[model samples]
Target chain A: MPDLLSPALIMIVAAMAIGPAKGHLRTAVLLLAPLITLWAIWQVPDGVQGTVKFLSYNVEPVEGSALRRLFATVFALMVFVGGLYAFRLARWYELAAAYAYAAGAIGVCFAGDLIVLFLYWELMALFSTVVVWCGGTPAARAAGIRYAIMHLLGGVVLKVGIEGVLISTGSIEIRPLLATDFSTWMILCGILINAAAPPVSAWLADAYPEASPTGSVFLSAFTTKTAVLVLILLFPGEPVLIGVGLFMVVYGIVYALLENDIRRILAYSIVNQVGFMVCAVGIGTELALNGAAAHAFAHIIYKALLFMSAGVVIYRTGKTRCTELGGLYRTMPVTTICCIIGALAISSFPLTSGFTTKSLISLAAANEQMVWVYMTLTAASAGVFLHAGIKFPWFVFFQRDSGMRPKDAPWNMAAAMIIFAALCILLGVAPQWLYPFLPYPIEYEAYTAGKVVFYLQLLLFSGLAFFILLPLMKRTETISLDVDWLWRRAAPWLLQQGSRGLQPLLVFSASTWQSLEALSKRMAVNYLGQPETADSEERGLFARSWPIGATALWIAILLSAYVFIYYTD
Target chain B: MSDSDSQDFLSRPQTIRRLWWGFSIVLALTVAAQLVIYVKGYFVVDGWFGFGAVYGFLSCLLMVLAAKALGYFLKKPADFYQQDEDDA
Candidate 1:
């Protein structure tokens, strides 16, 4: 009853209804659920608290605070809308798994203990793979297999770190660690891998677009954002992440700039968006952490909004690549406008959601006098506008006007996008709506002439560069190289070569064993002559010693007699 | 356990042309609201600025289009991995 009183309970219950309930009931479950969830989440008072325990571990499954509660609230809302968008076309398993996955993400938001967080963390991993596998394409199946392996490896590393912390510190509270120890860094890496930091970045673009449209929408929301949330809670002030985050920031833009598929470009941009949050967490100031959290908050809305547009395109035309798709603004005008809103928000254009929030983190870098990090982040901001903010909407909606326009998004799909689009603008227009919920008080201003003009000029110029350099940047039918190449291409190749290299060793061992066997048999025969055995001087000098001794004695006796006679004369 | 009883609901492909049109109408309303805001003193700009901001918008737009053109060419076939890889 305590949990049921919460909106998270209602939203999840409604999501479960997507799979089975017949006809109109499913429709009701789809559309009205998110609203109800939003209402219930609104009612959860500040400082509302509850807990449940098992196995001598007290699990703070629900600690109701404005911050934790808001994240959970958004997560629930994401699920309901995602459910509405999905349940119609998505398979039962995909629908069911997505709901369970959302619950896990919301579960983590509410978890006050590391143990509970770990449990939910693994849950997110398990169900997301199911969603990816639900793509049902051959590509989906292969990508899903690889996706599962990568996440499971990440989970093992995380679990090892958790166990190490539990053994050494004798606690499992979900509090910030300075990342001083091996265990902590391992835990951070474990989480960062999910955040799609370097080296493991290939798994995301490799997997997500292969997923069914509905699944991609769900996949985009949870995993990396949860990593950001964990970083906010666990390693808030670690400076190493600044360098790491910067690398991911620009990496996403360049790779995305090179990407051809609409969803995959957005996929790379997710890492880039997460890099902002990662940097904020690295800055570790209250405002910076809030920026990270608020950015995560707005990010979920805008990122999901972009995915919805792409999903709509994929659904109508069954084409996902930017090359195959262009000039849809002619047919799908509504989708175009909504996607533009999302794009503007992600680019941090003045008066959009991204404008209000992402700057706080970047500003924090500036205030800290971290000039290199600041410049890197600023260029990355421009890069965001270049790759995702403009590129996504332009290719899918406007561009050369590909002359084939199906219908706009379905009611559920449009509704989801509209709701998110509203949030993106609402928060931007009035920062107070999202500000208080941040981990830190945001005393910063989002709308200054200097700042706005600077961002615009940077983004505007980048746009010019993209156009000016257009000839060099042609979309060849190729995927840009990624860190995942190590596993997907390089490791598999090395494995083949390694086996090739071992062939000689195998042959040498086989021949050597055979020769040794023959030698052992010859020795076991006792004598080479066998039954007619004769041992002779051929056995060597040790056997012939007595003949030489007898001859020497006779010679010595005669030599002594001759010597004595000579001496007497 | 049988959904055949609800066959009418289950079988129909659901023509949402009306719904789609309705949502578009709503979008028009929002765009109108923005137009209204522009009309009133609360407006940030004079209007959507059809050709007035042409260079700014076009420079941004064409830049995106060209990048997109390149992206299309750069895009590997969906089966790019398979082209280089054989399971054996």
Candidate 2:
């Protein structure tokens, strides 16, 4: 019990202590503390390690189970990678808040009961908003406020759902709750919103890109992936997620196909990848679950690598759009190479990390005999190559020569990319290492020859399509609209329209009140005269003379009237 | 790495040749690695099914070409959207 409490407290304190430092010291502390917390997390052997009871309600801070450990492991790794990208350039305050956010994520993953999960979940919401605000721009500040509001609303829904579930079910263990109750569905929706699932996914592309470059790198790792983890645990085999996941996948590709901004393209694709995970959770097979976990790990490294490369470009040239930048490969070869490696990995080119992991989820779909969904996933895979895989590097590095020749990324940045790229290839070649740690046992082979050949042909054909269709894929002045535009643009326009109509009614009411006051004042002054003031020296006639005489006369009259009435009756 | 020398590689294409050679070598090496895996399949009497090696190499080649082709469109003039003074 003390052991679990100790690590959470330790990580929280480490985060709080980060505010006082500056320069390299700040970076070191932020990066190092998570490593220690990670080690502490795995120190206990697996299965129910800590508990406390408050008579009716019992709580466990640490549930040393395989599922919990798997999530905690990834959360810890994210901390390190997030630190690597962020600490080098982020303000100490930002780094501090980021570490605190990470600690909260780890806390949630390790939590055994609903109450603890809710607490850590809200903490994650709180601290991540602080990190977003650290972008220190008007756009970031506004986006952060919106981001915070959305998360707080989600948190409230989740808390109410948790209470309801606890009351009805009489158990708070964080395991498969099924899709039976409104409370469970509400919880699922709340979590899905963080996962960047439909309708509200605009929050991610809108809010994330506005953050500081380092902040984006950190922001990319945690929120959606953690939701994937929760879904895997709680909603496995729920068939509805299959359709919902499919929607997210197609929506992501179509939106990204039309997007102009580079990071937002990546952001939408994050939804697409999590959609794959969500589908895997829905499939609920052994291979599907394993694939979801493996894909998540690979996605983290490659996505972070992608964001870091983008950050390096933005840091040097202060540009982010494909339209604004090009020909950088002339000087920044390392970054170009790094970005390409990340792209290939994302495209699931056969020998990269993505193929090794992502194939399992697709294979799981095939095994389930879901042909249409399977076909859509295959098409989405091709579209991934089209937008993110091809478009990102092509536009960023090698196009008709932007003639801006920034030097290669700073050494630390290059080191981070190289490490991730190596891991991408390593994992692809020797997937056995990743295979063991997945949430479920994986009986499927990722590198079957027939399957590999088919995938290559299909994806290569898609590459051909990308080049053939390049004319339609040009950068333009106008922003490509999405469901988010409905909120960020149309909703705001509607709100302004509403307020405009409201303005006249409010003004008319105020004017009417003023006119009524004027009429009353005019009537009093001209005809009735004002009442005596409160501080006048003499009493009024009504107050002083009437009460005693009136009381005696009224009493005698009432008695005579009563006697006459009684005789008449 | 100091900001003083950050502009050292700002105008050169020396890495361009290196990138070309390096990418070719990578293409070759990746294909060779997969070819070894493919050769073991030759003994199993499924010659028609033994296109994994070719498919693998072809995928790498396709990837690099896609790299070149995409390089055609989205890559723009570095100062394409910047203010005029920043361009100078």
Candidate 3:
């Protein structure tokens, strides 16, 4: 064993302790585990720290780099904050599952080989399903099953690719590879599925909102962001990601615009935000990679803050629809303010974390002179402000009053939101703190005069458009269908239709067989002997009785004829 | 929690009107700031005066309308999936 313990182990062990421990002891484990993990994360020096023999291969379970540390830092931070939010209210099992899920994500951050990465990846899939199921509703159970299926499918595809890579390249070390071969392409597809890329992206919007309020907050932080991290590590510069990323950006905006559920809106926006990172990774320059890494970091905080606020609403009012929520700003001031800050940060407004990190991606695109991608991404930026930045706060907090006044979040939840909300602004204002931790050296400024002015014009006008078209964007108690409809609705309907279509053929075949049997029986009755009685009329040839002496005489005559013919031949 | 007493100031009609006017002015100033400050842009067209405002507004308009149009096909009742679960 290496001198430095794996940070993932600490969280997993804490997760184990959480279920049986009670009161302050459980709380102590919940709060201290992540802090201890954070300390352990920093303790590991750069490069591969240790290896263990597994089967025939020496697997690297711990690697240290700026990128790895950055991701692990956020994962640990998320666990700590998420624990603080949930410890008081969340069920013991939910808290346990959430910690385990966080441990899986942290494990992936330090994984030094494909095999190690895969084990952690699956650990995440298994436990996140448990988190989703913690919602404890039939809906949650069903959604958890669907969520499990999609991620497990992704894991299988990833395993197949890793196995193929190991066979062809004779190595399992996690390194950059292009989608130029079957194995690499499979790897890219697998990662994209986890990233919630299109056609298969609906599982995220379907599942996250259905989890328990606090569970959703934990659910929101880990899975897709881990997918983004691995993409940064394994498949940077894969050109297909640009198109996939752009689609996600636009898809999120459109669907979120049409959605009525508050958390579902945020869930779609997760896809949209990850789209930015995925696109940045595709750009593949040092600046682009930094943008992707920094954006992931900033995104996790603000997105979690947003979820935390929404979770508070769901926790207080048991209502998830936009139509059922309004005028909350008066009563739940802290949550409203924190949510707005998160919204602004997501919109990449002038002095928020989103602005600082997301602009780096657009800057990367511009540096490459990819005019179309730059333009489209610039437009998508405005779209984000419309769907998430204004729409979320407006519908839930500021629109026509629902005449219900729920109290503010409980102290711990409020503290969690305030902490992340503060981080959103802090990182935005002082990106120098974040930039140094990026994988590459920094050579960019986030708040140049031109950039700030340009972004302000873009976002503010989009805000204008939002209010101007408020009627069109009204909540309608509806959900927009996505590709998951294939399994959720279309595939099942197809099976039903198929069975309906096959019914007549099956009947026809059965009738035909019955008639053939009758015909054969009639032929036997006519050609061969049968009992000539009314009771035996329906009997088939094999069922009929014949006179024994006549039958023996006929057999003997036939045998003699056969013997004569054989002798003549 | 009283409906009349707890009505938020921002929701009052007068405050709303004032907010609308204030917001409009800020929007105008962002575009007008281009006169004094030369806002460098990577793309040629993006550099044009009020381009960000115009493009941003237009893109949002297009997206909202596009979503509304898509809603006709894609939008289903809140229990869309739940209905299937019930059948099963």
Writing each residue's lDDT as its tens digit, candidate 3 over A1-569 gives 66435789999999999989999999999999999999999987899877889998999999999999999999999999999999999999999999999999999999999998999999999999999999999899999999999999999999999999999999999999999999998899899999999889999999999999999999999999999999999988989889999989999999999999999999999999999999998889999999999999999999999999999999999999999999888899999999999999999998899999999999999999999999999999999999999999999998888888999999999999999999999999999999999999997878878777888999999999999999888789788888988998889989999989999998999999999999987788765546466575556656667799989999999999999999999
Alpha-carbon runs more than 4 Å astray in model 1: A1-17, A31-51, A504-569, B1-78, B84-87
User: Could you tell me which residue pairs clash in candidate 2?
Assistant: A47-A64, A395-B74, A395-B75, A402-B77, A402-B78
TM-score of each: 0.77, 0.80, 0.90
| Chain B superposition TM-score per model | 0.39, 0.34, 0.90
lDDT tens digits, residue span A35-133, model 2? 888888777566666778755677887766566666677667767767776666888888778878877877877777888788888888998899889
Q: Of all true interface contacts, what fraction is found in model 2? A: 0.00
- Writing each residue's lDDT as its tens digit, candidate 2 over B27-75 gives 4453444444442222233223324334333443443455345545544
The best candidate in terms of TM-score? 3
Model 3 off-target regions past 4 Å? A501-569, B1-7
Worst lDDT run of 10 residues, candidate 2 chain A, spans A536-545
Candidate 3: CAPRI quality band: medium
